[model samples]
Target: SHFIVGLTGGIGSGKTTVANLFAEQGIDLIDADIVAREVVEPGSEGLAAIVEHFGEHVLQSDGQLDRSALRECIFSQPKQRLWLNECLHPLIRKRMLELIKQSTSAYAVLVVPLLFENGLDSLVDRTLVVDISPELQIKRTQDRDGVDKGQIENIIRSQMPRQQRLDKTDDIIDNQGEIQEIEQTVFALHKQYLSLSKAVLS
Candidate 1:
């Protein structure tokens, strides 16, 4: 089996920043969000199935999946959400596994925003949760995405409770500090994961 470390955080938790710092240390990143998008790109089976079930309105004029439209569709219909997940999760997981297999780093970082929600921890040897304050999460998400506070709060509500996520994580990276400090912590974790990977691989 491959040595995999899962990095997870809620929206606006700066997971990308922390992941980049590890990438700088030669770690490969298998980002679930990116894989999710890739699986639904134009002409993919995933997209075709989506269109078949949801109709063409889920796609933009250029034929790409209209993320906002799909989101709205699922948001208004819980059954649609479950159906879409059933349609897409297997494709996403298959692609993610392919990416992980291609990774040649000491250990790959499987960065997922819904690591716990999607039960992705089973794919990794260890899990890292990036923790941040709710107030900061709202502010950062609003600044980065131009999303309103109510929408951001809704996203937060949709995720596992902060404490529950923490209880399940093997490692916790605090994103409440300065970027310099966070980078330093990432470097430290990189070293730790490298050693841990060695132990596991040996």
Candidate 2:
């Protein structure tokens, strides 16, 4: 397997943007969020299991998962949230690993937003945390999603604390600056990862 870097960040910390920059350098990306969605698409067993447990109301008229409705239900009910995670986490992990094995790049980025919290760090050779101030995270999330500040705060509280996430990471990208700055940081990491991957192979 290629060397794996687990990339994570708090909500609205521009993780996807950073991932895109790495992708531009020809690194493969196995994104947990994307695989999470895939596991629950219309004909998938994941969606079928959800409908079985949470009922068909979790589905839209087109038979797709009603993500907003499911999100609201889970957030308001702790038991429901637990049950949903129990159902989805294994499926997500399975798919993520399968994709990672298919990568042919010098190194691959495994983008898991809950990398630390979910114990996904074990899957990677190194960890990268994209960091921003808490205030910036709150503002960016609210502005991007049009959600209430309270909701954004709650989501942040649910993840690993900011400093702890940084402390555990093998690399950190400070994402509070301009787009050009972030790009330059990612470019440097790309080269570093290439070297690290070769070292691992040797």
Winning candidate number (lDDT): 2
Model 1 clashing-pair count: 0
Local error of candidate 1 at residue 140 (angstroms):
1.9
Q: Model 1 segments beyond 4 Å from truth?
A: none
- 1-202, model 1: which lDDT tens digit per residue? 2789999988899889989998898889998988998999998999999999989999999999999999988987989999999999889889989999999988999999999899878888999999999999998899988978999999999998899999999999999988888887888888898899889977
Candidate 1's TM-score: 0.94
Write candidate 2's Cα lDDT for 106-162 as tens digits: 999999999999898998999999999999999998888899999899999989999
TM-score of 2: 0.91
Candidate 1 residue 64 Cα shift, in angstroms, is 1.3
Best by TM-score: 1
- TM-scores, all models, native as reference: 0.94, 0.91
* Residue pairs in clash, model 2: none
